[model samples]
Target: MRATVIHAPGDIRVEDAPEPKIVNPTDAIIRTVATCVCGSDLWPYRGLEPVGDPHPMGHEYVGIVEEVGSEVSNVKPGQFVVGSFATSDNTCANCRKGWQSSCLNREFMSTCQAEYVRIPNAHGTLVATDEHPSDELVPSLLAVSDVMGTGWYAALAAEVKPGSTAVVVGDGAVGLCGVIAAKELGAERIIAMSRHESRQKLALEFGATDIVSERGEDGIARIKDLTGGIGADSVLECVGTSQSMSQALHSARPGGNVGFVGVPHEVAVDGQELFFSQVGLRGGPAPVRRYLPDLIDRVLSGHINPGKVFDLTLPLEQVAEGYKAMDERRAIKTLLTP
Candidate 1:
């Protein structure tokens, strides 16, 4: 099988690698049908995160089940499935509380940008569709596996409510999906903070009522001005940078909330500032398994089309170019077909 390997920062290559096998009784191997480059993958690609020895890349995937271990009974061979980046047993205490991402037996997927992937905790992590979906729904189904799910979690964490004002502090794929989530959750006013024309347009199409193209203190001020000087009722901090985090914190009114989903990079909160601001904060890896069933249904029903975030598509063999396009901001997200 061919897989994406990062030999070093700014270096991505597609090379032959051994196919994965069931290392545990709960494991299942799936022949990847669709996968994509995630914003998080850029961390190591841009040298923001260290890339030690070369290793396979990617985590978001939708595939056809090729085989399952003896203990796996939730799915069978030949079924189409979508799974989260964080695999969980789903039977654990955390999972029972709706936090599958923090399950006792959890494994983070890191080799999905290939022809085949071994899914851990198959019984609890993989959600199979009733039947094989049409080719047109594949991209949206693949989006439900990660980006859309993460965006939903961001909205939930921020406590987006009916007729409330919500702010999204990023223009990436996840943030765009956050706008969709906020709209579906009944946010009457959705403010998307973006500087890119393409992203701003997409955000509007996804239900953004306003766009704030400023940054730093200016962005927060714009959010306040739009919210009648009280700031928004909820803020989704989709970017993990310190500046973005601060913007999210300041963009929310007192007693409001901020849901931060970005993998925090050099981000920290000032204790005094947070205490005085009285804003609630919650974030981490999304429990995508908990929302997979509904998100998949939404895709199949044509209720939400988060797949539109993928502005570029490439064959799995051209994975390097996918990474380059996303890194250069030429594409919001890249869809990779195997």
Candidate 2:
């Protein structure tokens, strides 16, 4: 099998690697049908996030089960499934509380950008569809595995409500999906901060009622101006940078909330600023498994199409190009087919 390996920052290659197999009775092996690059992955690619050693890359995936361990009874061979980037035993305490991303037995699903990959805790980590999904539904279903789920978590954490103004910071795939989630959650006003025309257009299509192209304090002022100086009721911070995080915090009203889902880099928050702002803050890795079922249903029913985030699609062998396209911001997200 061939998989993506990042030897170092700016060093990525798709090369031959050992195939995966059932190592645990709770595991299952799946042949990947589709996978994609994530913004978080860029942390290592850019040297901001260290790679201790050359290892497998990619976490988001959707594929057909080829085999399952003896303990995995809920899913079977030949079933199409979507899974979270983090594998978890659904029976854990955290999982029971709908925080599967922090499950007691959690593990990162790495090196999935290959022909086949092993899924741990298959029964709890993987969600099987009612039936095999068609090719047209694959991309959207694929988004449920990570980006869309994270976006949904942002909306939920921010407590978006009917008739409330929800501001989304960042226009990446997850941010755009946040717009979709906010709309579906009944937010009357959706403001997306994006300078890119392509992303702004998609944000509107996903239910954004306004677009703010400013940055930093100016962006915060724009959000305040739009909300009559009260700021928005909810703000979704999709970019983990210090600038974006501050903007998100300032964009919300004193009693409002900000949900940050971006993979934090060199970011530090000021205690005094947060204390004075009086805005609630909450966000971490999304408990994708908790939201997978509903998101899957939405995709299966064709009620939403979050998969439109993938502006570039390429063969798995061309995973290098996929990364390049995203790294250069030439594509919002890149989908890979194996």
Candidate 3:
């Protein structure tokens, strides 16, 4: 087996690795069929995040279960599954409250960028549907593993409602999914703030009612114009930057809510500014596992294809090329196959 390893900044390689084996009663092992490079992965690659030691690099995947432990019941050895970025024991207090990311005994999720991975707490962390689609739907299924989940979280946190005007910040995969999420929640007007033509097209396809091509005050002006001088009813922040965060804040009307799901690189908010506004702020590391079941059903039923965000594909050995394309802003997202 081979896994993607990041030895240092601007460095990535495929190294021979041993096949993962189930070591606990609740554990399961899966062979990776499809995986993807996320915007978060670029932080380490671009030296924006620390790289203290060589580490495995991926957190999204969809594959077939090669083996399962004795205690695993819901999922079997031969089933196809989609897993969250966090591994949790579904029986725990937090898991039952729709917050599996904070499960009492949750295990830190490892990158699934390899050919094989050992999934702990398999019964609680993995979900199996009827029939797994062929290679064509693999990318879409894998999207539910992370970005799509995070986007859905953003919509929920923002308190979106039908006939409500919504604004989305950032044009990444997660932001685009936020568009789909807002639509699913019945937002009457979806305003996608995107400068890139490519992502703007996808945003519209996902149900954005309008597109704003400006930044700073100008972007906010466009959003206000669309809403007839009032701001949006809700705003979803998908970029973890001060500028993007500020734009989201300025685009929401009084008493509106903001759902920020970006990784929060170095965000700072002005207390005085927020104090005078009626907008509410809330968001954090997404509880992706919370929505996996509903999302998987939608995918399996063909209600959505969030996986269309992947604009580039590469073989496992050429995984480095996939990273380069994304880091250089040449591709929206990259999908890798084993």
Candidate 4:
């Protein structure tokens, strides 16, 4: 089998790798169909995270199950399934409480950007759709594995509710989807901060009511203006930078909620500021498995299409170019087919 591997910073290659097999009673082996480059993956590419020797490259996909372990009763052979980026045993205490990403007994679904992948706790981690979807539905269904779920979590964490103002800081794919989630949750006003026309358009299509082509204080001011001098009721911080986080906190009204989904790196909150502002902060690595079922159902029913995030597509062998495109900011997200 061939897999995408990052040998070092800026060095991505397609290399030969051994085929995967079911190693646990709850495991399943699946042949990869579609996968993509993720924003988080860029950390290692940019020398932020230590790029281990010849590490596998992705954590999202939709594929055909090749085999299932003896204990895997829910997923079966030949079923088309979508899985969470992080796998978990559904029976665990954390999982039962809807925190599968932090399950006490957890195993991550091996990198998906390869010809084959080993998914542990298959029965609990993978969701099988009614039928094999059309080629077009594949991309959207693929999103249920990660970004879409994370975006939904962003809105949920922010406490977005009916008739509330929801401001999203960041114009990335997850931030755009957070706009959709906020609207679906009944937010009356959805403000997306973006200057890029392409991303701004997608945000609008996803249910953004207004666009703020400002950053820093200008962006926060726009949000405040939209909210009639008061800050928004809910703010979703989708970028994992201190600038974005501060903007998120300032964009929300006092006593409002701030949900951050970006992978924080050396970020800290000022105790006095938070105390004086009276805004609530909540967020962490998204427990995507918790929303996998409902999200998959919505995609299967054609109610939402999150695949719009992937603006470019490439073959598995050309994955090196995919990473370059994303790292260079030339693509919003790149979808790769194996």
Tell me, by lDDT, which candidate is best. 1
RMSD (Cα, Å) of model 4: 1.1
Query: On a 0 to 100 scale, what is the lDDT of residue 73 in model 3?
Result: 89
- How much is the lDDT of residue 58 in candidate 1? 96
lDDT at 212, model 1: 94
lDDT of 2 by residue, 105-134 (tens): 999888788889999988899999979999
lDDT of 1 at 192: 98
Model 1 stretches with alpha carbons more than 4 Å out: none
* Clashing residue pair totals per candidate (backbone < 3 A): 0, 0, 1, 0
Greater TM-score among 3 and 4 belongs to 4
lDDT of 1 by residue, 1-338 (tens): 99999999989999999999999999999999999999999999999899999999999999999999999999999999999999999999999999999999999999999999999999999999999999889989999999999999999999999999999999999999999999999999999999999999999999999999999989988999999898999999998999899999999999999999998999879999999999999999999999999999999999999999999999999999999999999999999998
lDDT of each: 0.96, 0.93, 0.89, 0.89
Better of 1 and 3 by lDDT: 1
Best by TM-score: 1
Clashing pairs in 4: none
- Candidate 1 local Cα displacement, residue 101, angstroms: 0.3
Q: Tell me how many residue pairs clash in candidate 2.
A: 0
Q: Which ten residues in a row have the lowest lDDT in candidate 3?
A: 103-112
lDDT (Cα, 0-100) at 10 in candidate 3: 88
By TM-score, highest first, what's the ranking?
1, 2, 4, 3
